[model samples]
Target: MKKIIKTTLVLLITITTISCGNKSEKKEADSKKIEQTEEQQHSSSENSIQLNNGNPWMANIETTQGIANMKKLMDNFSKKENSEAYTQLKSSLEKEFGTIITACTMEGESHNQLHNYLVPMKDYFEGLASKDILKCKKTYNELNKHLAEYSTYFK
Candidate 1:
Protein backbone atom coordinates (compact mmCIF):
# COMPACT_ATOMS: atom_id res chain seq x y z
CA MET A 1 0.00 0.00 0.00
CA LYS A 2 2.81 2.38 0.87
CA LYS A 3 4.53 1.52 -2.35
CA ILE A 4 1.37 2.28 -4.27
CA ILE A 5 1.06 5.64 -2.57
CA LYS A 6 4.69 6.48 -3.28
CA THR A 7 4.37 5.52 -6.92
CA THR A 8 1.28 7.64 -7.29
CA LEU A 9 3.02 10.59 -5.65
CA VAL A 10 6.00 10.32 -7.97
CA LEU A 11 3.78 10.24 -11.04
CA LEU A 12 1.72 13.17 -9.82
CA ILE A 13 4.81 15.28 -9.16
CA THR A 14 6.38 14.42 -12.48
CA ILE A 15 3.22 15.29 -14.41
CA THR A 16 2.70 18.47 -12.46
CA THR A 17 6.27 19.59 -12.92
CA ILE A 18 6.22 18.90 -16.62
CA SER A 19 2.87 20.51 -17.25
CA CYS A 20 3.62 23.60 -15.23
CA GLY A 21 7.04 24.07 -16.86
CA ASN A 22 8.34 27.61 -16.17
CA LYS A 23 4.96 29.28 -16.01
CA SER A 24 4.87 31.31 -12.82
CA GLU A 25 1.20 32.10 -13.39
CA LYS A 26 0.18 28.50 -12.80
CA LYS A 27 2.78 27.66 -10.19
CA GLU A 28 0.67 28.72 -7.25
CA ALA A 29 -2.36 26.77 -8.42
CA ASP A 30 -0.29 23.71 -9.14
CA SER A 31 1.32 23.97 -5.72
CA LYS A 32 -2.07 24.07 -4.02
CA LYS A 33 -3.16 20.97 -5.87
CA ILE A 34 0.01 19.15 -4.90
CA GLU A 35 -0.36 20.25 -1.31
CA GLN A 36 -3.91 18.98 -1.17
CA THR A 37 -2.83 15.63 -2.57
CA GLU A 38 -0.03 15.35 -0.04
CA GLU A 39 -2.33 16.32 2.80
CA GLN A 40 -4.73 13.59 1.85
CA GLN A 41 -1.95 11.03 1.58
CA HIS A 42 -0.43 12.01 4.89
CA SER A 43 -3.74 11.84 6.71
CA SER A 44 -4.61 8.47 5.26
CA SER A 45 -1.31 6.90 6.16
CA GLU A 46 0.84 6.96 9.26
CA ASN A 47 0.32 10.12 11.32
CA SER A 48 4.09 10.66 11.68
CA ILE A 49 7.28 9.35 10.19
CA GLN A 50 8.32 5.93 11.43
CA LEU A 51 11.67 4.60 12.50
CA ASN A 52 13.46 1.87 10.60
CA ASN A 53 12.94 -0.93 13.08
CA GLY A 54 13.97 1.29 16.03
CA ASN A 55 16.76 3.12 14.22
CA PRO A 56 16.92 6.25 12.12
CA TRP A 57 16.61 5.77 8.36
CA MET A 58 19.81 6.20 6.41
CA ALA A 59 19.19 9.09 4.03
CA ASN A 60 21.00 9.85 0.79
CA ILE A 61 23.61 12.58 0.68
CA GLU A 62 21.45 14.87 -1.43
CA THR A 63 18.48 14.46 0.85
CA THR A 64 20.58 15.22 3.90
CA GLN A 65 22.26 18.18 2.23
CA GLY A 66 18.97 19.62 0.98
CA ILE A 67 17.43 19.31 4.44
CA ALA A 68 20.44 20.98 6.01
CA ASN A 69 20.20 23.83 3.53
CA MET A 70 16.51 24.21 4.29
CA LYS A 71 17.28 24.39 7.99
CA LYS A 72 19.76 27.18 7.32
CA LEU A 73 17.20 29.00 5.24
CA MET A 74 14.65 28.72 8.01
CA ASP A 75 17.14 29.93 10.58
CA ASN A 76 18.02 32.94 8.49
CA PHE A 77 14.37 33.79 8.01
CA SER A 78 13.78 33.48 11.74
CA LYS A 79 16.26 36.23 12.43
CA LYS A 80 14.45 38.65 10.12
CA GLU A 81 10.79 37.60 10.47
CA ASN A 82 9.68 40.08 7.82
CA SER A 83 7.62 39.56 4.70
CA GLU A 84 10.67 39.76 2.44
CA ALA A 85 12.62 37.25 4.48
CA TYR A 86 9.61 34.96 4.63
CA THR A 87 9.23 35.09 0.88
CA GLN A 88 12.89 34.34 0.43
CA LEU A 89 12.64 31.38 2.76
CA LYS A 90 9.69 29.99 0.87
CA SER A 91 11.49 30.37 -2.44
CA SER A 92 14.66 28.80 -1.08
CA LEU A 93 12.72 25.90 0.38
CA GLU A 94 10.95 25.27 -2.92
CA LYS A 95 14.32 25.12 -4.66
CA GLU A 96 15.74 22.80 -2.04
CA PHE A 97 12.70 20.56 -2.38
CA GLY A 98 13.37 20.27 -6.10
CA THR A 99 17.01 19.56 -5.43
CA ILE A 100 16.13 16.80 -3.01
CA ILE A 101 13.68 15.21 -5.39
CA THR A 102 15.94 15.46 -8.40
CA ALA A 103 19.00 14.17 -6.59
CA CYS A 104 17.31 11.42 -4.66
CA THR A 105 19.13 8.08 -4.84
CA MET A 106 17.28 6.13 -2.21
CA GLU A 107 14.93 3.34 -3.22
CA GLY A 108 12.37 0.90 -1.79
CA GLU A 109 11.13 1.45 1.74
CA SER A 110 13.66 4.13 2.51
CA HIS A 111 12.42 6.31 -0.32
CA ASN A 112 8.83 5.87 0.70
CA GLN A 113 9.74 6.80 4.26
CA LEU A 114 11.38 9.97 2.99
CA HIS A 115 8.19 11.00 1.26
CA ASN A 116 6.25 10.35 4.47
CA TYR A 117 8.59 12.74 6.19
CA LEU A 118 8.42 15.44 3.54
CA VAL A 119 4.67 15.68 2.99
CA PRO A 120 3.87 17.56 6.18
CA MET A 121 6.45 20.25 5.57
CA LYS A 122 4.39 21.27 2.55
CA ASP A 123 1.60 22.26 4.90
CA TYR A 124 3.83 24.54 6.90
CA PHE A 125 5.22 26.09 3.73
CA GLU A 126 1.68 26.76 2.56
CA GLY A 127 0.98 28.48 5.86
CA LEU A 128 4.06 30.64 5.41
CA ALA A 129 2.56 31.98 2.19
CA SER A 130 -0.16 33.76 4.08
CA LYS A 131 -0.13 37.55 4.48
CA ASP A 132 -0.67 37.53 8.24
CA ILE A 133 2.60 38.11 10.03
CA LEU A 134 1.39 36.70 13.32
CA LYS A 135 0.11 33.57 11.63
CA CYS A 136 3.33 33.22 9.72
CA LYS A 137 5.27 33.53 12.94
CA LYS A 138 3.20 30.82 14.52
CA THR A 139 3.69 28.58 11.51
CA TYR A 140 7.38 29.43 11.55
CA ASN A 141 7.65 28.15 15.09
CA GLU A 142 6.02 24.89 14.08
CA LEU A 143 8.19 24.59 10.99
CA ASN A 144 11.32 25.21 13.00
CA LYS A 145 10.38 22.43 15.36
CA HIS A 146 9.70 20.11 12.44
CA LEU A 147 13.07 20.87 10.84
CA ALA A 148 14.85 20.32 14.10
CA GLU A 149 13.17 16.96 14.42
CA TYR A 150 14.45 15.77 11.03
CA SER A 151 17.79 14.63 12.43
CA THR A 152 15.97 12.22 14.68
CA TYR A 153 14.64 10.24 11.71
CA PHE A 154 17.07 10.83 8.85
CA LYS A 155 20.83 11.04 8.96
Candidate 2:
Protein backbone atom coordinates (compact mmCIF):
# COMPACT_ATOMS: atom_id res chain seq x y z
CA MET A 1 0.00 0.00 0.00
CA LYS A 2 2.86 2.42 0.85
CA LYS A 3 4.62 1.64 -2.45
CA ILE A 4 1.39 2.27 -4.41
CA ILE A 5 0.84 5.56 -2.53
CA LYS A 6 4.42 6.74 -3.28
CA THR A 7 4.04 5.91 -6.93
CA THR A 8 0.77 7.78 -7.18
CA LEU A 9 2.28 10.83 -5.40
CA VAL A 10 5.20 10.90 -7.82
CA LEU A 11 2.90 10.64 -10.78
CA LEU A 12 0.74 13.49 -9.52
CA ILE A 13 3.78 15.72 -8.94
CA THR A 14 5.13 14.97 -12.37
CA ILE A 15 1.81 15.80 -13.99
CA THR A 16 1.58 19.06 -12.06
CA THR A 17 5.13 20.10 -13.07
CA ILE A 18 4.41 19.38 -16.72
CA SER A 19 1.20 21.33 -16.61
CA CYS A 20 3.01 24.38 -15.14
CA GLY A 21 4.94 24.87 -18.36
CA ASN A 22 1.75 25.44 -20.29
CA LYS A 23 0.48 29.02 -20.19
CA SER A 24 -3.24 29.66 -19.81
CA GLU A 25 -4.96 31.96 -22.30
CA LYS A 26 -5.31 34.56 -19.55
CA LYS A 27 -1.52 34.55 -18.96
CA GLU A 28 -0.82 34.93 -22.69
CA ALA A 29 -3.28 37.80 -22.98
CA ASP A 30 -1.74 39.54 -19.96
CA SER A 31 1.74 39.27 -21.54
CA LYS A 32 0.47 40.78 -24.79
CA LYS A 33 -1.14 43.65 -22.86
CA ILE A 34 2.18 44.38 -21.06
CA GLU A 35 4.06 44.44 -24.37
CA GLN A 36 1.58 46.84 -25.91
CA THR A 37 1.85 49.20 -22.93
CA GLU A 38 5.66 49.20 -23.18
CA GLU A 39 5.53 50.00 -26.89
CA GLN A 40 3.40 53.09 -26.22
CA GLN A 41 5.84 54.62 -23.70
CA HIS A 42 8.58 55.48 -26.15
CA SER A 43 8.94 59.06 -27.43
CA SER A 44 8.69 60.08 -31.08
CA SER A 45 11.16 62.89 -31.70
CA GLU A 46 9.84 64.10 -35.02
CA ASN A 47 11.89 66.71 -36.89
CA SER A 48 13.67 67.39 -33.67
CA ILE A 49 17.15 68.87 -33.40
CA GLN A 50 18.49 67.83 -30.00
CA LEU A 51 21.54 69.50 -28.53
CA ASN A 52 24.42 67.68 -26.87
CA ASN A 53 23.70 69.23 -23.46
CA GLY A 54 24.06 72.65 -25.15
CA ASN A 55 26.16 72.04 -28.26
CA PRO A 56 24.98 72.92 -31.77
CA TRP A 57 25.90 69.38 -32.78
CA MET A 58 22.35 68.07 -32.86
CA ALA A 59 21.84 65.16 -30.40
CA ASN A 60 23.10 63.63 -27.18
CA ILE A 61 25.51 60.76 -27.92
CA GLU A 62 26.04 60.19 -24.23
CA THR A 63 22.49 58.97 -23.77
CA THR A 64 22.50 56.92 -27.00
CA GLN A 65 25.74 55.12 -26.07
CA GLY A 66 24.47 55.01 -22.48
CA ILE A 67 26.41 57.17 -20.02
CA ALA A 68 26.58 54.22 -17.65
CA ASN A 69 29.53 52.83 -19.59
CA MET A 70 31.37 56.14 -19.31
CA LYS A 71 30.56 56.34 -15.64
CA LYS A 72 31.89 52.81 -15.15
CA LEU A 73 35.14 53.58 -16.97
CA MET A 74 35.64 56.78 -14.99
CA ASP A 75 34.94 55.01 -11.70
CA ASN A 76 37.45 52.24 -12.45
CA PHE A 77 39.89 54.49 -14.32
CA SER A 78 42.82 54.29 -11.90
CA LYS A 79 42.77 50.52 -11.42
CA LYS A 80 44.00 49.45 -14.89
CA GLU A 81 43.88 50.66 -18.44
CA ASN A 82 40.83 49.61 -20.43
CA SER A 83 41.86 49.76 -24.07
CA GLU A 84 38.56 48.25 -25.15
CA ALA A 85 36.51 50.93 -23.42
CA TYR A 86 38.79 53.61 -24.80
CA THR A 87 38.43 52.28 -28.34
CA GLN A 88 34.68 51.99 -27.98
CA LEU A 89 34.37 55.53 -26.66
CA LYS A 90 36.40 56.90 -29.56
CA SER A 91 34.37 55.03 -32.14
CA SER A 92 31.06 56.16 -30.66
CA LEU A 93 32.28 59.74 -30.39
CA GLU A 94 33.20 59.79 -34.06
CA LYS A 95 29.90 58.41 -35.25
CA GLU A 96 27.82 60.64 -33.01
CA PHE A 97 29.90 63.80 -33.36
CA GLY A 98 30.32 63.30 -37.08
CA THR A 99 26.59 63.04 -37.56
CA ILE A 100 26.02 66.11 -35.40
CA ILE A 101 28.71 68.27 -37.04
CA THR A 102 27.72 67.31 -40.53
CA ALA A 103 24.13 68.26 -39.88
CA CYS A 104 24.96 71.78 -38.71
CA THR A 105 26.25 74.77 -40.68
CA MET A 106 29.96 75.58 -40.31
CA GLU A 107 29.14 79.05 -39.00
CA GLY A 108 26.71 77.83 -36.40
CA GLU A 109 26.73 79.93 -33.22
CA SER A 110 27.78 77.22 -30.78
CA HIS A 111 30.32 75.59 -33.12
CA ASN A 112 33.47 76.64 -31.24
CA GLN A 113 32.23 75.62 -27.81
CA LEU A 114 30.92 72.33 -29.17
CA HIS A 115 34.12 71.59 -31.11
CA ASN A 116 36.35 72.48 -28.13
CA TYR A 117 34.53 69.96 -25.95
CA LEU A 118 35.14 67.26 -28.57
CA VAL A 119 38.92 67.80 -28.98
CA PRO A 120 39.87 67.37 -25.32
CA MET A 121 37.87 64.14 -25.14
CA LYS A 122 40.49 62.66 -27.48
CA ASP A 123 43.16 64.27 -25.33
CA TYR A 124 41.72 62.47 -22.32
CA PHE A 125 42.18 59.14 -24.16
CA GLU A 126 45.72 60.13 -25.10
CA GLY A 127 46.49 60.98 -21.51
CA LEU A 128 45.26 57.55 -20.51
CA ALA A 129 47.63 55.86 -22.96
CA SER A 130 50.66 57.73 -21.55
CA LYS A 131 49.62 57.01 -17.93
CA ASP A 132 49.20 60.68 -17.19
CA ILE A 133 46.52 60.37 -14.55
CA LEU A 134 46.81 63.99 -13.44
CA LYS A 135 46.61 65.24 -17.02
CA CYS A 136 43.67 62.99 -17.77
CA LYS A 137 41.80 64.24 -14.71
CA LYS A 138 42.56 67.81 -15.62
CA THR A 139 41.40 67.20 -19.19
CA TYR A 140 38.13 65.79 -17.91
CA ASN A 141 37.62 68.90 -15.81
CA GLU A 142 38.30 71.02 -18.87
CA LEU A 143 35.82 69.01 -20.89
CA ASN A 144 33.28 69.56 -18.15
CA LYS A 145 33.74 73.30 -18.37
CA HIS A 146 33.37 73.20 -22.16
CA LEU A 147 30.15 71.26 -21.86
CA ALA A 148 28.83 73.73 -19.30
CA GLU A 149 29.46 76.53 -21.78
CA TYR A 150 27.65 74.53 -24.42
CA SER A 151 24.65 74.10 -22.15
CA THR A 152 24.57 77.79 -21.37
CA TYR A 153 24.46 78.95 -24.97
CA PHE A 154 22.76 76.40 -27.24
CA LYS A 155 19.95 75.33 -24.98
Candidate 3:
Protein backbone atom coordinates (compact mmCIF):
# COMPACT_ATOMS: atom_id res chain seq x y z
CA MET A 1 0.00 0.00 0.00
CA LYS A 2 2.81 2.41 0.87
CA LYS A 3 4.60 1.57 -2.32
CA ILE A 4 1.43 2.16 -4.27
CA ILE A 5 0.94 5.57 -2.77
CA LYS A 6 4.52 6.59 -3.45
CA THR A 7 4.40 5.27 -6.97
CA THR A 8 1.14 7.05 -7.64
CA LEU A 9 2.49 10.32 -6.32
CA VAL A 10 5.58 10.02 -8.50
CA LEU A 11 3.42 9.30 -11.51
CA LEU A 12 1.11 12.17 -10.72
CA ILE A 13 4.00 14.57 -10.41
CA THR A 14 5.43 13.30 -13.66
CA ILE A 15 2.09 13.60 -15.39
CA THR A 16 1.61 17.09 -14.04
CA THR A 17 4.99 18.11 -15.36
CA ILE A 18 4.27 16.57 -18.75
CA SER A 19 0.92 18.27 -18.85
CA CYS A 20 2.62 21.56 -18.10
CA GLY A 21 4.53 21.36 -21.41
CA ASN A 22 8.18 21.64 -20.27
CA LYS A 23 10.49 21.31 -17.27
CA SER A 24 11.34 25.00 -17.03
CA GLU A 25 7.68 26.01 -17.08
CA LYS A 26 6.92 23.51 -14.35
CA LYS A 27 9.71 24.90 -12.21
CA GLU A 28 8.46 28.41 -12.80
CA ALA A 29 4.93 27.42 -11.96
CA ASP A 30 5.88 25.63 -8.79
CA SER A 31 8.03 28.55 -7.63
CA LYS A 32 5.57 31.22 -8.65
CA LYS A 33 2.87 29.27 -6.87
CA ILE A 34 4.47 30.51 -3.66
CA GLU A 35 6.24 33.79 -4.20
CA GLN A 36 8.52 34.27 -1.23
CA THR A 37 11.91 35.93 -1.07
CA GLU A 38 15.03 34.25 0.28
CA GLU A 39 14.79 36.29 3.50
CA GLN A 40 11.23 35.17 4.07
CA GLN A 41 12.23 31.56 3.59
CA HIS A 42 13.85 31.22 7.00
CA SER A 43 12.03 33.82 9.08
CA SER A 44 11.63 32.81 12.69
CA SER A 45 8.15 32.12 13.86
CA GLU A 46 6.73 33.65 17.07
CA ASN A 47 8.15 30.75 19.01
CA SER A 48 11.57 31.46 17.51
CA ILE A 49 11.60 28.16 15.65
CA GLN A 50 13.26 28.26 12.29
CA LEU A 51 11.88 26.54 9.22
CA ASN A 52 13.89 25.07 6.36
CA ASN A 53 15.86 27.95 4.93
CA GLY A 54 16.31 26.45 1.51
CA ASN A 55 12.73 26.36 0.24
CA PRO A 56 9.53 28.33 0.63
CA TRP A 57 7.50 25.10 0.69
CA MET A 58 9.07 24.21 4.03
CA ALA A 59 7.94 27.32 5.89
CA ASN A 60 4.96 25.62 7.53
CA ILE A 61 6.36 22.20 8.45
CA GLU A 62 9.85 23.01 9.75
CA THR A 63 8.62 25.47 12.38
CA THR A 64 7.91 24.94 16.06
CA GLN A 65 4.23 25.04 15.27
CA GLY A 66 4.59 22.21 12.80
CA ILE A 67 6.49 20.04 15.23
CA ALA A 68 4.03 20.76 18.03
CA ASN A 69 1.07 20.09 15.83
CA MET A 70 2.56 16.80 14.68
CA LYS A 71 3.06 15.72 18.28
CA LYS A 72 -0.48 16.66 19.17
CA LEU A 73 -1.80 14.92 16.14
CA MET A 74 0.09 11.76 16.98
CA ASP A 75 -1.23 11.85 20.52
CA ASN A 76 -4.75 12.26 19.29
CA PHE A 77 -4.22 9.44 16.84
CA SER A 78 -3.89 6.99 19.66
CA LYS A 79 -7.43 7.54 20.83
CA LYS A 80 -9.91 4.73 20.17
CA GLU A 81 -12.63 5.11 17.54
CA ASN A 82 -11.83 8.71 16.82
CA SER A 83 -12.55 8.50 13.11
CA GLU A 84 -13.51 12.15 12.66
CA ALA A 85 -10.38 13.45 14.31
CA TYR A 86 -8.24 11.02 12.36
CA THR A 87 -9.77 12.24 9.14
CA GLN A 88 -8.89 15.84 9.83
CA LEU A 89 -5.40 15.14 11.10
CA LYS A 90 -4.63 12.84 8.20
CA SER A 91 -5.66 15.50 5.72
CA SER A 92 -3.50 18.09 7.43
CA LEU A 93 -0.46 15.86 7.55
CA GLU A 94 -0.79 14.87 3.91
CA LYS A 95 -1.00 18.53 2.96
CA GLU A 96 2.13 19.31 4.95
CA PHE A 97 3.93 16.39 3.32
CA GLY A 98 3.10 17.87 -0.04
CA THR A 99 4.58 21.18 1.07
CA ILE A 100 7.78 19.51 2.19
CA ILE A 101 8.30 17.68 -1.07
CA THR A 102 7.35 20.63 -3.20
CA ALA A 103 10.04 22.56 -1.39
CA CYS A 104 12.42 19.73 -2.21
CA THR A 105 11.61 20.13 -5.87
CA MET A 106 13.05 23.63 -5.71
CA GLU A 107 16.51 22.30 -4.90
CA GLY A 108 17.31 19.91 -7.82
CA GLU A 109 19.51 16.89 -6.90
CA SER A 110 18.96 17.55 -3.22
CA HIS A 111 15.29 17.06 -3.98
CA ASN A 112 15.94 13.45 -4.98
CA GLN A 113 17.78 12.63 -1.78
CA LEU A 114 15.28 14.43 0.39
CA HIS A 115 12.41 12.79 -1.41
CA ASN A 116 13.92 9.38 -0.77
CA TYR A 117 14.19 10.03 2.94
CA LEU A 118 10.80 11.67 3.33
CA VAL A 119 8.74 9.16 1.37
CA PRO A 120 8.82 6.45 4.02
CA MET A 121 8.21 8.97 6.78
CA LYS A 122 5.20 10.16 4.89
CA ASP A 123 3.93 6.59 4.73
CA TYR A 124 4.46 6.18 8.45
CA PHE A 125 2.70 9.44 9.13
CA GLU A 126 -0.23 8.20 7.12
CA GLY A 127 -0.24 4.99 9.07
CA LEU A 128 -0.23 6.89 12.36
CA ALA A 129 -2.98 9.13 11.15
CA SER A 130 -4.95 6.01 10.37
CA LYS A 131 -4.93 5.35 14.14
CA ASP A 132 -2.47 2.49 14.16
CA ILE A 133 -0.69 3.06 17.46
CA LEU A 134 1.85 0.30 17.01
CA LYS A 135 2.72 1.56 13.58
CA CYS A 136 2.92 5.08 14.93
CA LYS A 137 5.32 4.07 17.68
CA LYS A 138 7.46 2.15 15.26
CA THR A 139 7.45 5.02 12.82
CA TYR A 140 8.31 7.52 15.55
CA ASN A 141 11.31 5.42 16.51
CA GLU A 142 12.32 5.20 12.88
CA LEU A 143 11.96 8.94 12.53
CA ASN A 144 14.22 9.63 15.51
CA LYS A 145 17.06 7.79 13.81
CA HIS A 146 16.70 9.88 10.67
CA LEU A 147 16.17 13.28 12.27
CA ALA A 148 19.82 14.03 12.78
CA GLU A 149 20.72 12.88 9.30
CA TYR A 150 17.98 15.10 7.86
CA SER A 151 19.19 18.13 9.78
CA THR A 152 22.82 17.57 8.87
CA TYR A 153 22.38 17.23 5.14
CA PHE A 154 19.33 19.37 4.52
CA LYS A 155 21.00 22.52 5.71
Best by lDDT: 1
lDDT of 1 by residue, 110-155 (tens): 8888998888889888777777788778888898898898898988
What is candidate 3's lDDT per residue for 10-122, written digit by digit as tens? 99999997887787788997787666654456442222322346542332234324434554555555543454555565676667656554543335544444555565666
Report the CA-based lDDT of candidate 2 relative to the real structure: 0.50
- State residue 17's C-alpha deviation in candidate 3, in Å: 53
Please tell me which model should have the higher lDDT, number 2 or number 3: 3
User: What are the Cα lDDT values of the candidates?
Assistant: 0.84, 0.50, 0.54
> What TM-score does each of the candidates earn?
0.68, 0.34, 0.39
User: What's model 2's lDDT at 120?
Assistant: 48
Ranking by TM-score: 1, 3, 2
TM-score of 1: 0.68
Question: What tens-digit string does per-residue lDDT give for candidate 2 at 1-155?
Answer: 99999999999999987777565666898999998877665422321334556444542444323333444444444433444444454455445555555554534534554454455456655543444545545554554454444434343
Measured with C-alpha atoms, the lDDT of residue 91 in candidate 2 is 55
Score residue 109 of candidate 3 by CA lDDT: 49
